[model samples]
Target chain A: MDISPDESIFLHIGPVALNATIVYTWITMAVILAISWLGTRKLTSESKMSRWQNLLEVLILGMKNQIRSISHQEPDKFLPFIGTLFLFIAVSIIMSIIPVYQPPTGSLSTTAALAICVFVAVPVYGIAKHGIIGYLKYYLKPTPFMLPFNVLGEISRTIALAVRLFGNVMSGSIIVAILLSIAPLFFPILMQALGLLTGLIQAYIFAILSVVYIASATRVHEEKEQKFEENRKGKE
Target chain B: MLINWFTVFAQIFNFLLLVFLLKHFLYGRIISAMNVREEKIASRLQEAEQKMMDAEHERDLYFQKNKENDERCAGLFASANLEAEAQKKELIENARRQVDEMKKRWNESLREERDVFLSNLRKRAEKQIYIILGKIFSDLSNTKLEQNIVETFLGKIKSLDHTERNHIKVILKESYNKAVISSTYEIPVEQQHIITAEIGDAVGETVEIRYINSQDHICGIEFKVKNYRIGWNVDDYVKFLEREVNKTLEEELAG
Candidate 1:
């Protein structure tokens, strides 16, 4: 009773000592892969959905609907990348129930990497739809002098999105681990529920914020570019 | 904070693979099969409608042809009836002509037979009369005297008038009394000699004797200035007509 099962976890990486969290991470990955395979294989449009398909469909729909509602633009293209991000974060956060389980989203590396992916994808899609010169016109809106502040604001929002998910998920993991170490059993349930709820909230926030960023970047510029291209064709 | 990049990367990659698999296998096959079945049903319905239209067109052609044939048959029937009626009329007319020709031929033969029979009868009557007249007139040849009158009263003229009506009647009456009538029933020899001189004597009047079928019969007048009347009776003519008709009928029936 003196030594806890939670502390016994350690990793032997050729000479370095690492915690047992790696095992839990590997197990979570296996769970996600198995679920994805089965869910995809069993997918039926008319039949009842599996838990994995339901989760995926819901997360994708939420992102799409929110993006469409905000910008009134087609949002289905943004869904896959956003849905992947949501699924990764959700699985990571839900694994916090294990004593050594900590979400990858807690690390600045993981959240920033995802944020950067969303960050780069938005501009890439925008430039693909609208030319470089046309995309720049979006920043010139309200005034050309407002470009510096607008660029700063956009970079800051990307940073905020990353940090916010990492903080929330990491905080929930730390709180659960500390509480479980102290009370051990009955009290851990309370921490687990809190961690689960917080994990879901963090996932939703990350997905929606990323969709908003991408939607803002790509939405209006593409419209004006279409009209411009049409006019150029007419002039020709 | 714990970071498990391996798990995070694995899960994302797995989800992407699943989406691709579903797009290729499951949804693709179901949608394609549904479209093919729908196209088959539509084509079958179209074929059935086309067949129905073709059948209706064929039926109309058949019905139209049948109507034409019926009309042609009616025309043929009417033509046949008219042809039959024409042939019947021609046959009736031919029968009438034949009957008329037969009646004409029969009348001709009847007249010829009557002439032959009447000539025989006249010869026989002549023979009988010659015998009777010879007995009565043999002694009176030199005397040649006779007179007769229908009216009992006579008037004599002071001078001779040859154009008097009474004198013609008196001459005709004297010839009749001498040759045809007498108190001793004697025929005058002079009247006989006069009758022999003329074939059908004219003595101011003519006498007609009708036979059954002959155009004329013998009529003679013998008188010094008038002639006696001589003609066959209606009863004798009727009997002669019946005898000749019966003879022709018997010959035709025998032949």
Candidate 2:
């Protein structure tokens, strides 16, 4: 059995191969976009809301609140990135229970791509808030000699993010496949349920970690500004 | 390694695309709708607060107006009470005044009526006394009484001063020496002749005498010589008694 969806390639064109992971990623994206369109097409601004709209609001608001609480910043600026990451991962994991579907998150490629986005977004947000020079100055904090370690830590944490999510999702699928070969029915269903749980957990972890990284980058500048304000007030 | 570099890049692009799509379709609409609902609630709350203030102001104004009305009503009621009391007093005073005036008028009318009644009774008594005196004088009237009256009158004429005797003579001469004798009753011819002779001797002139019976003399005799008159009778004594009685009654009323 293939360990990940990437191993199952249905088509090949030069170096660009259409694999199960890519196909499933597209399917997940399509389903998310379609549902988003349908859910938001008839939005009412009044206090009263339909059940489906209420559910969507609760989910969206919960995620935004979580992001805001962790980051100590406005959630709107990072909601699209953070929300997309969570939805894509969670949708992939939920769709895995279907017999005809393979989860895209079980692939190393998708996890690495999500991790890279977070990694790239961290620097972008930091640069946007503190400027490039101010953001780079954090690496030289405490001493200039700790720069390489801070850089390595950044790279290692990104790698850890990608590897951790990929490993958890792939192992769940692999364990379910092994369980299906031995007992085919009840155990596989149980393992799949457990896998769904693990998948949801992994999605949460990934979204939280990304929010932490973004917040870490921006928090230092915010603190500096706060301290400067306090010092100005003290002088006054 | 299950890593595919191309797939990784493709997935990154796909993830960015999904972020863009969801931001456009879902988060934006939801946030905007929530913001709109919040705005409506805030505006409604502000409107409610304004209305509450307006209601409170109106209530205060109404309370003030009610207080003023109550005060005005109380003032009006007090004034009305005072005016009513004053009017009642005035009415009582006027009634008392009218009653006093009526009493005064009634007393005056009663006094006037009593005075008139007393005056009428006194007049009747005087009339009765006059009738009794007339009857006594008539009973007492005789030739001797007349002769004594004539002699007393002649003595009074002899006692007269010369100027009065001359005035009587001049009056007698103006009337061609004619004189009239008036009496309430008929006198005897002899008495008349004697009165005339004594008057001539006293006056030193002989006067022609005419005798007239006059009931108004009330048993008195009057001798008229032109506008001059002289005589004596029982009527003089009766008149003196009547004057004494009227004077005594006047003294009693004064006392």
Candidate 3:
């Protein structure tokens, strides 16, 4: 059995290949896009709205509130990146209830891609808030001798983010598959239900971690500005 | 083997594309709609508060106007009551004045009537006394009261004082020595001679005497020479009795 969806190549075109991970990722993207389009086609400012509209608003607002809480900032700037991560991962995992469907998050390549995006987003947000020199100054906090360790910690945490999501999703499916062979009737359904819950938790964890990383990088400027104001008031 | 480099790059591009599409479609529309709804609710609340303030102001104005109207009505009522009281007092005063005037006129009329009645009674009593004295003298002495009155008038002429006798002589001289002797009854030629002689002796003049019969005398005689007069009549006694009766009536009315 192919342990990763990336191993199951669907097509080969010259130098390129189409695999289950890519196909499932596209499917998840299509499903999310289609639901978003259907829910937001005729948005209203009125109190009365359709149940579908209500559900979409609840979902978007919930995501915005979560980002705001974690980042300690306005959610508008970070909503697109963080909200997309949550929706894509959640939809991909929830679709695993199908018999022949493979979740894209079950593959290490997709998780690694998401973690790399978060890893890259952290520096991009940090550099945008402060200058390149100011963002790099965060590494030499307390001492310059810890700079190498801070850099290794950053790379190692990114790898851990990818592996943590991949391990959970992959192990849940694998366990369900093994349990199906042992007791195919009730246990698989129970395990699949548990998998769904675990999958949603993973999605939440992944999105929250990304927000925390981005917030840490961006918040340094705010902290410095606050400290500067406090020091100025002390002098006065 | 589990990491596919090509697929990771593809997923990254797909995820970024999906984020752009969703930002354009879902979040933008929903947040804009919510903001518009919030602004509408806030404006409606502001409008409601303004209307409530306007209503309260109008109510206060109405209460003030009602209070003013009540005060004006009370003032008018008090003034009207005072005016009515004044009119009532004036009317009572007018009625009392009218009553007093009527009473004065009525009392004056009663006095006039009493005076007229007393005069009529005096006249009647004089006539009655004259008749009674004539009858009594005729029955007692068997002589006429006119004869007696003529004798008494002659005696009064003879008993006159010197000053009164001179006053009569002067008046007779000024009157061309003409003297008039009037009586209720015609005197006999003998009594006329005696009366003429007595008056002539008293005045020391030979006076021309004219005799006149007058019904105004009540069994009495009168002699006149110009403005001077000598008379004796029962009418004087009747007038004195009438004055006494009037005085007694006034005293009884006062009591």
Candidate that scores best on TM-score: 3
Residue range with the least summed lDDT across 10 consecutive positions in model 3 chain A: A220-229
lDDT of 1 at B150: 9
lDDT of 1 by residue, B104-170 (tens): 7877776677667656655555444434444444555543222221011011211224455355446
Per-residue lDDT tens digits for candidate 1, residues A136-156, read: 787886589999998888788
Show pairs that collide, candidate 2: none
Query: How good is model 1 by TM-score?
Result: 0.43
> What is the C-alpha local distance difference test score of candidate 2?
0.85
Root-mean-square deviation of candidate 2: 7.9
lDDT of 2 at B209: 87
True contacts kept of 2: 0.88
Task: Report the lDDT of model 1 for residue B245.
Answer: 62
| Candidate 2 Cα deviation (angstroms), residue A117 | 0.4
- Enumerate residue pairs that collide in model 3: none
Cα lDDT tens digits for candidate 3, A1-236: 78999999899999899999998888898899888878877778888877777888899889999999888999988998999999999999999999899999999999999999999999999988888988888888647999999899889999999999999999999999999999989999999999999999999999999999899989856697578779999999
Off by over 4 Å in 1: A1-27, A42-71, A223-236, B1-255
Q: What is the C-alpha lDDT of each candidate?
A: 0.57, 0.85, 0.88
Question: Per-residue alpha-carbon lDDT of model 2 for A80-130, expressed as tens digits?
Answer: 899989999999999999988989999999999999999999999999988
Candidate ranking (lDDT, best to worst): 3, 2, 1
